[model samples]
Target: MLYSAKDYQRVRKEKEELDLGRSQFRRDFARLLHSPAFRRLQGKTQLFPGHESDFFRNRLTHSLEVAQIAKGLAQQINKRTPAFKRRSIDLDLVEFAGLAHDLGHPPFGHNGEHALDDCMKKYGGFEGNAQTLRILSRVEKKIQAAIGPSDDICGITPEGIDRRLGLNLTYRSLAAVLKYDNPIPLRRKKDTPLEKGYYESERELVEKIKAHVGVPTASTKFKTVECQIMDIADDIAYSTYDLEDAMKGGFSHPMQLLAKVGDESLLTKLHEKVAKEVPKVTPDEVFAALTDLFMLNGADTPALEQYTTSKMLASDAKMRSEFTSELIGRFMRGVSVTHGTGADIKFSKVEVAREIRIKIESLKHLNFLLMIMSPRLKVVEYRGYEVVKTIFETLDSEEGHLLLPDDLQVMFGRLTDTDSKKRLICDFVAGMTDRYAVEFYSRLRESGASIFKPI
Candidate 1:
């Protein structure tokens, strides 16, 4: 087998049942599927708030879409490449990567993440990618170690250790989601709002993952094929689906976005970005690409340059769906496997064709600017930042561990180290969904708060 037995080894050794027929990766997927962290995703924000319209995708739906795309992409590569056909990318593994990819995004999306990072500047800075690793290794309460009768509600820990084992997932499963390998610093040089590495708390587990997965200990970078596919799937999803939400929300349409073509500054920003990513694409090529991509229905190109209001909604639901489907198909056609640095599965990288990537980047930046940066969403984003920050502060206050739920409170009370305690509070606050975060903040600070409210 190309993958060694160590790849399937879990951190805490336990008696295994007879194979019966399920793959280890499938078990990993099942574990994540049934976890509270995964379930919380449904109430978390994606491109827009879930309550505004059920048609808008939440984090849960977006994750499911990513898993579908990642598995499909893996199949496409395996079917086309002889080497990959011989040592096929595990479809279940890629799907698990996709599903677990966003498991660490706090309530209110990036806004919430930023709030948590700012709060943890002195402790290990918070990052969604890093938090994902933390959750898989230690945060989730699937397995607990040997503990006193008081600590274990069920019994003296089944794992026979003295720590909480997040999921006791296989080493390969942990490696699949280890997006950024570096341990996050206590304080960044620039104090960036977000950091892209794992927390110090999971440092030991991460090292074990690398050793078990056959990645060189000295390697500076590490990203498995499945993780790359999951990342690409995530990009493809938000870029297309978020645009669908915008159109459905009556925000703007393709032709209406032509107005952006007139903004030389914005176009230059986009041109530089496209040029950087796609190389050799000129400013004129960018302008032409924009017009070619969005100038549909034989719409007069020159008039749309003057198009302003979203009221010019020239497309219907059928048109939007067709456009999105065609775009997604184009992206899929662009994918292939290529040689890469590092060891084992990390030795390969997924490449999206330049032309298709150009379209993807264009559409992504357009969605980010037009929808994510829109004043309409900005108001909510600002509110999200405040809510998340407030909740973190309240939970970290004097005697704050008292407010945590019984399960979290038990963990928090046992920690004596300051950093560990603060991290426990950070985890408590970061695990909330958008709805829950709002309710939490309201109960703490809002007037006429009900004591009957349940977290």
Candidate 2:
């Protein structure tokens, strides 16, 4: 509410200025919306690969859905809570956060992400959230300065030879997507999974963002008010829409999920995952929540029980649609907002009701166990992992720089440092679409090596 002009300050001065009478955040949204990185999301997978069916959610569609949900949440808070009427959340900022949140995700979804992280473990760990920051702050290619000559991105002083300011987005807009505050370590702790933090390359830029937003540099969590809404909106979309996609894919429906196909171990695994998301959640509670959620016959519990043997009735399309819509509406109502104590209203904390939280966690983990962790999808994911790494390795070979495009080749030629050069390779591989990655891998490794057409 107490924002200053610094909140709208760009990391670097614009190379070209055009004032068409748009708000600063509006221009931020336009820059992201029109970028090639955002357009590539149409080719990227969300939960199921786009090849699975035309109806499945992709990254672009998912991000759009998140934006809509986030705007709804912000509007709800602004109108419903009296505290917000005085200092309301900016709808544009929250919507921009929602739309731009997942732009850094690599091809083939998390499968490709894990593969790239494994490839770059020695240089810098790869993460979706972290990549989002990198794409906005450094990678998307909006502004480039005279190399090593003068001012830095934050108008400080240039350090790296590649003096590019991605979209030159505002500090507040950047902070809205700054989900994790920690910097990803070069080498992850032994026996731990990939870390979820920004790269060391963007540390100074992050410091500038936090300082401008009034967040302490020493704070562990740097999530902003807009970020909180976007995070919850992301969860809500993942929980409901993925379930909707699952039903359409015929992977799981009410009857199938309810029965668990009589697999005791599968049921136990689902409960374990649910417990991780919602601590101390019992198996009974998980099933109870699912039962309540998937009861398809509106709130008519007896009717659903009466037709336990009828799979057609359970899988009705109209009923499933109504169920997901109801679930989403209820969860949206669960979000609550509060300001921090003291003279500074610096941060706003958001809390969702435990009931909705349980349902969301339950449904999300259901998809995780039955779909993501399933053997059917695992085979394809394993192949994706191989494709990603093999591509990175081939491109990082002695003469690999020759394979890069003209623009990239120019940058590659400028840098003498090996780490910086290898990072350029990582960035190239990390930006491929699923089909593009496969095609490129086939040309490089398989029988179809091509020199006739441009890659």
Candidate 3:
């Protein structure tokens, strides 16, 4: 509602208008849904490794869930809040943000991301959020034309001008996906892990986006209310759905977890993990919360024993589905918006209730402890790290550099500096899906396949 019709306009106008009876936000959603980047998410890892099971959720499905939750949140806000009821939140824009949020994630999820970051340490660092911005603004293909003389032709130039317009997304839609405002530092910091932010190379474009979206120059946290909604929806989907995946895979059982509710060591670990984001959370609070949620009826026995002995709650699909659905509904109802004026704006800050936040955080911690950090997953993650590292090294070497695709070869040749070339290499490897990365690695190391084998 803070935006005007002009703010939803694309960077490059279409030659002939085709009124599909869709709003600008809906069109933005369509553009992303049809993109190759979004499609590649089907092959990218979500919680478990992609190759591990056909039933596990991939990045594509995860994004779809996020979009649904985001739209639901937007609708809830519009129905409940007075200010939103007057101005109305755009459901399409919120959905667009959620769908586009993870478009830039590399193969193998966080493990692959860490590998790419390590490879790019000497160059500008790699962050999935930063890559998402880059993909939207510059990397993904878009319409183009020669704006200048033919003599200046270079990489990605059909004529004399290189028109890498990406999706040419509208300002408000772009703002909704600009999850972090800070720029990654040129030099690596020894004391901390690589921070997630926009790339320094995209700084001017980011500023342009902010200006168009009417964000104040001096605001410390530049997130828009729609972006905040998308962020919370992402958290909700991750906390609830990943747990469902683990349960289906039999990696975690609710009754078993309930039995461990009083285990001091497990509770301590959960507390430590949760406290990283919510500093004041305690072990007892997390345990009590999970116990309350998972325990069925007023059965007198310990939850663990009851779950083990009782056939109804343990294996019932309906029960599990109902529990997840109820949690999502509860969290959705917890969302609230605050309106500000003047330099401050209406619907400026969106928040979930403190108790709901803690519950979601606890769910996330349980997922992390029970599934993501398990020893079996660690082995797969390490192999993923090696695969990404080896592939980058092979392509970066002088002999192997010759084997790059023609387009990348041209881009690499045009960039003279070491860091620039390295960054391009990072881009190439980071765009790969999990299966592609593994296949490429196998071709380089084990298969000894034909030279004509396409990349």
Candidate 4:
């Protein structure tokens, strides 16, 4: 919140060419919102396809919601805090970061991310967050470069530094967009094991952001409070929106979802897994725990009081752990209490709103386990990987090589090493969408669908 549109330094050399009405940061961030990559988010999955149900939120809608929430948070903090006001924290930067945060998510949501990460393990790996950064700064150029720029696009000249590549964002704007503070290579793999942040390929850009913005990376991890706000906003949207999608798709009704948490079979599984000392007496407490978790609301004082009271019962470590798992189960059922704003998608409230965010994120690990990594999802992932693999192999063949870009053709023609070629092949396939991958694979294999226009 320290910097503003006025304070942001321009990345472009032509200060005289700069538009007086819009600041350099604002202009760059605005371009991202209007980008084809940003628009492609509409076709990408959130929890499920937006076409699957009208009630569900797609990636585009979700990003718009996050942007609104982030801007609201910025305005509120700036108004309340004298330091924020003095520092001139631009709402546009926060809004832009929120909007562009998830632009690089592949098809099939996090399942696609897992598949890509596994596929690209030797090639510096893959991460959704890192992919998003890559898209804004690089990958989008694959398409944009093929087509010449129009008046709608700003500072995009093919010749000058490949300005078409990155969002050409100011250092501060890009920094605001980075939710995770730690760079990939500097991290100890065993110290904290999570692959949900920026990638090693992005180190140079990271350094540029740090140096230009005058921010320090202390404690080996550093995130601005603004980034924290955007991260929490993303969390709130993800938890609630996924639940909404499930409900609309008839995956789980709220009543049945609540009932299933303490179901007899689930209780048996929990007891067996947790190995509670007082097995006989703990089941009822567990039932109460499950109920308190699913039914608890944090939007009102009574709900907060109930949540607090329920937590008081978790005095012992075993009870706490048991309760935590039960809460997770409820979340995985994809059921959530509605606040009746008709999916209004604003996160502007102060006191109780923060608590809602806390409750949602508390179950993130559970959500990850149940829905994200479940056998059903993995089956789909396997299918997606097969599609990518087949496509990559076909494209590398003599017949398929004809479809490639000129640079790719020349590089592939000259490259003799299998490893380097395979990496390039992965890059090509990684850039394809679910439909594109499937279509290309089908055509190459002479399979079910027709690749050419049918009469």
Most accurate candidate by TM-score: 3
Worst 10 contiguous positions by lDDT, candidate 1: 153-162
Residue pairs whose backbone atoms clash in candidate 4: none
Alpha carbon deviation, residue 231, candidate 4 (Å): 0.9
- At residue 230, what lDDT does model 1 achieve? 89
TM-score of 1: 0.91
Enumerate clash totals for all models, in the order shown. Answer: 2, 1, 0, 0
Q: Kindly list the per-residue Cα lDDT of model 4 for residues 304-348, writing each as its tens digit.
A: 565454444333345434544454344323322111121111111
What lDDT would each prediction earn against the true structure?
A: 0.80, 0.81, 0.79, 0.56
Clashing pairs in 2: 11-153
Off by over 4 Å in 3: 9-18, 145-163, 189-192, 216-219, 298-305, 309-314, 448-452
Writing each residue's lDDT as its tens digit, candidate 3 over 1-455 gives 46665566656765324476787888778888988888999999998876777878999999999999999988988898777787777889999999999988988888888888877766778899899887877677654434544564343443323456678788788888888889888668544486799877788788887666776544578888888899999999999989777777777667776666567887888888788877787777787678666665544777556666434444567866787898899988888887665545523788888788878988887888778888988888899889988999899998677767887787677666777678778878888999889989988889756768787
Candidate 1 residue lDDT tens string, 1-455: 33678988988786665376778888888899999999999999999899999899999999999999999999998899776777888899999999999999999899999989999988888999999888877788787554556546531133333376788898888888887868888766445657788998788888888788876434356777788888889888877888888889888877677677669888887778777778888777777766766766455545635343223433466667777888788788889988443344454778898777777777788788778888999999999999999888988889777889876676666665778878888988888999888888888887635778655
Candidate 2 Cα deviation (angstroms), residue 232 = 0.7
Q: Give per-model TM-scores.
A: 0.91, 0.91, 0.91, 0.68
Q: Rank the candidates by lDDT, best first.
A: 2, 1, 3, 4
Q: Candidates 1 and 3: which is better by lDDT?
A: 1
